[model samples]
Target: MFLKNAWYVAGWDSELVGDALLARRLLGTNVVFYRGEDGTPVALEDRCCHRLAPLSHGQREGNCVRCMYHGLLFDATGRCVDVPGQERISDKLRVRSYPLVERDHLLWIWMGEPSLADPAQIHDSHWHDAPGWTAERGGYIHYKSNVHLITDNLLDFSHLAFVHNKSIGTRKQGGVKPEVTFSEESVSVRFTTIEGAPPPFARQLSKLPDLVDRFNFYVWNIRGNYFAQDSVIAPPGDGYGSQSPLAMKLHTFIALTPADEGSSHYFWSTAHNDFTTDIVDVTRQLTAQVTAAFEEDRNIIEAQQRSIDASPGAPMIAIAADGTLLRIRRMVDGMAAAEQARPVEQTLVFQPAARV
Candidate 1:
């Protein structure tokens, strides 16, 4: 699992509107999203305070969620407003509300201790407000795998050789020669394929600069612009056979948010310089491709989770191709450990929520 202090992509900005309840996950917590009467985005624990019924399953009344179970109403701040059929309810009664912000077409929520919620802490360097970059953003996918596994997959690039052979991999690109570098916060790998130069997909990208038939580039750009590309076989799990590509292109972003302990929601978006003129067509095409790729991954990850459940302490073998995966696992494990060791202090101050 990623650090609670770090920002996780929850959903797209367009999905968090209307008088409807939108359910999403962040930092392993389930949250229900809705808009207040003022049209600002608000999030609360999906489960109601009373009988734990999903508030998302109920109707949105103005800016509050009216629980269908017992007519309990919760405002944007999660303050309980009314208890139907009851003469009086405690003013202290409330459900947990999370601080949510929408930026760069992605919805971000603070799932850590409420006192630590700070928008400035979230990394927005690349996608927030950078010059010379044009981004076409959209919605995401829901996956059934552990969020960690999805992160592992994103951090490593070798899977392109086999799992994505039809879409992005070529026979000559099988040999490994990756440039690896890292920092306290991230790792990057870069690889160039000279022999199995370009796959079929590369033909479409031929119009781009610096791309040639003899030299095809495969870069795995990871955390906060930490870029890396290498040949690495992802750890194998039970249930799904790796076949068929679901995603459209090679440069798609894969973000994972833990829906719970056993399941995760996968959010993906692609940005490229070539499709600026026809972003809508490009986005639609990319979304369809990525959605298919996600399905392929879903089958495998779910099966792997089941296997892990059955065997609590099973050891697995890894090879040279797994160096990046190992590094990713170590990084994640280290982050988790560090977070546990030095918990961030939470301090709450009154600040008006940003209007969407």
Candidate 2:
């Protein structure tokens, strides 16, 4: 149901603290996140082996966590270091630790085999740390639907005409041609001929008084599930691709991490080169408006999930605009199927319970 070897966004860097435990479920597994004494992010299986108590319920002691149930202490590597009642610690007494890497103001975790958890395999979000780009830290959204639904909503922008009409989209965006480009590891959906009155977000951000030319670009990296959309608007000339300085661009970063089979944790961040403290208040207001528009999306997708659940065998059709979405689904399903077909090694060997 999920790509286990891929890197999933656990949470924003600002969301985790050295003293607090952030309990979250990823890829149908219960995991806990926190910062160590050196301020390094750490991820571990939330279940404690002794009584199966959630380690997140315990208190943080230095870089280790002390289970509240029996006062068992666990280190950052998920190793049981101390037990008040006993001095002998078995080597097998430990919780599974996930490899975590902190970059681009986000914490990413590898939920697969420990040996394959290489930090170098993580994807990069250049805009998050690039110079001259002001990165706005948009917070996460809890979606009560499958992760695929959210990805579908993002890859296809045709729905924006009606779904986000009052926010960042207009009716003019519906009938435009989407140029779909594909590669082995990435897919891009581009709309280069969008020309019409500025949407609410473009109007506020661009401060343009008349109709404008626009360019919308959406890209999906298949491996890490990092999705991005670039919206550019300007006067009736070439789009941002022509290096037009008059164009106003907003880059939105979105990544999805499965909380189970039916729910997900949405991580978002946006960067805009146009930063004006004079209009900072306006930007703040625009942020709230955009968040509300996304909530509108949340409602519709959740309703769709419910409908599907109610009618398990209902038939649904896809239109021409779903080209990119179909490609993404194919890629993801292939990855999951391949992972399932591979043999899993048994970490513990049993010889008829030691001939008992």
Candidate 3:
């Protein structure tokens, strides 16, 4: 339920390449993506005109996607270029094209009004662009819950004690209560963990001795560079427990984009000042670990959704730990309401038309 008007990370920079038709879901719509002859990324409705087959399954032919079912070719602009059997078709038959841009090793597509698509609005963290910090970029598992849940989880740092204890929490630190603060667009939670000596989860991070200490964890909604200890925790379902404290020292950038009613795309990048020389390798290992954690979350969230669907009328209960989740739900609901009240004519766009 984040702002649809804003730019969201779709895929890693390396994922997009020459004439490859990538099918991805963004803002509840199925989009077909490909690179043009000029090496620019383009997006269009996935559905083909000849048949309803997804253009993603079609062949990439010199910057155009040729429908596999009917051999109809469409250019990056969504114009029907080649109709194998027919000579001519009306312009109305053209597919809808969306604006796309590449930045900071990521692919961003406009899912709202094309005219409001502002590439500059896309949130980019300073560490990602800084000279000393090495970046490891990739994506994570798709979740069944709404995108808002993911954002809520990211914004909250208290779950580390119980849910992610094995990975990020120390038994001694669990008793420490956190002071939480919230703003219109972001939330900040701060707490302290014992300094010196690695906790149980830190065993895996024996290679990094400098990171063992009391840490700070901070989550901001808008866009800024700030460091906090790595006490942030995510819900645990599959017995993975939490990640080690040292892992949190490696800064992570996460972008959650809605795929549809019950799906989402999570793109992330990890960076750190210490592991600059081996950031890529460290990222590869960390990505695998982080992905496992997400998989654990996916199973639980999907099960939760199934339960909610089965008992729509039943009352739900919550505890103190659920505060962040509740706040996030409220924010999402509010955004949805605001969007609904506005006329469709005013939808956000990537590129606005010139004023008369």
Candidate 4:
């Protein structure tokens, strides 16, 4: 159900420490992520070859992880380096190592063919390592709903009117139709509100006039599963920032990884270029507000998931506001279908507990 050839966010740059092992499930496979002694990121199958124990449960020995169940040591490359009781370690005694790269303060991993894993394919987000932008990252939430359900909720902004009425949206901005456009690599959904009042969260940045222009843009990379939302509120303007004095921008990047078919791991962060020296504190406050709004969404989405699970045959009726969501669903369905139809030799089926 996932696009295997793409890079998915394994964790934040700060999550993996030199002496700690982080275990995360991506695309239904359990994987362990850690930083080596030299501060390089490494990703390997979480399960050990011997006794099928989780490597993350074992302790780190030097640069390698020694299986706690049997004292088998595996290196960053997933090769069996030492076995306490055996004189000769079998070459087949190892786990699969995934290609991992650190970019934009996030660790991304590839789950498909090693030959096709390219670091250049990682998607970039605005305000990530930007000159004047301040970002608050390392925030995550687990959802009981499918990953696509969250994607559907994100692609359509109409829900913001009700879901986030107290924080970022008002009834005035919900009815506006987004100008949707697509390219070979990505899809853009944009909504513009002119002469509208700023939301509660934006008001915290600065004092503004009664009516301002608000712009919300969502850019989705179809193949890579990367999504970014750029929100700009400015003086009733020509475009982006014609009036620099009264402009504020908040950018959010969402990394969605399927923990399994029924659940997902969602990571997000917010950034802005409002205050220079105090930007970090400003971003932190903004992040907390957004987190509260996300909790509201989490409650709703999880309840919806429960309903779907209770009624397996229930059908959802899509409305006009669901245009972007439906298109994305169709694209995902097509990709999953194509992957299923491919020849067995062309696909690398990864079993979560299997040894390399």
Give the total clashing residue pairs for model 4: 0
lDDT of 3: 0.62
Q: What would the per-residue lDDT of candidate 1 be over residues 206-266, giving only the tens digit for each residue? A: 3322222232233333332222221211112211221212111233455566777777776
Which residue pairs does candidate 4 place in steric collision? none
In candidate 3, where is summed lDDT lowest over 10 consecutive residues? Answer: 347-356
Top-lDDT structure, candidate number: 4
Tens-place lDDT per residue, model 3, 79-154, is 8878877887777567777766677677766665566676666555556677856666665567777765566556
The TM-score obtained by model 1 is: 0.76
lDDT of 1: 0.60
lDDT tens per residue, model 4, 68-137: 8989998888889899978999988988888888877888888877667767778775367787777888
lDDT of all the models against the reference?
0.60, 0.78, 0.62, 0.80
Candidates 3 and 4, the one with greater TM-score: 4
Error of 4 at 246 (Å): 2.4
| Ranking of all candidate structures by their TM-score, best first | 4, 2, 3, 1
TM-scores of all models? 0.76, 0.92, 0.78, 0.92
Superposed model 4: Cα runs more than 4 Å off: 275-281, 344-356
Listed per model in order, the count of residue pairs whose N, CA or C atoms clash below 3 Å is: 14, 0, 20, 0
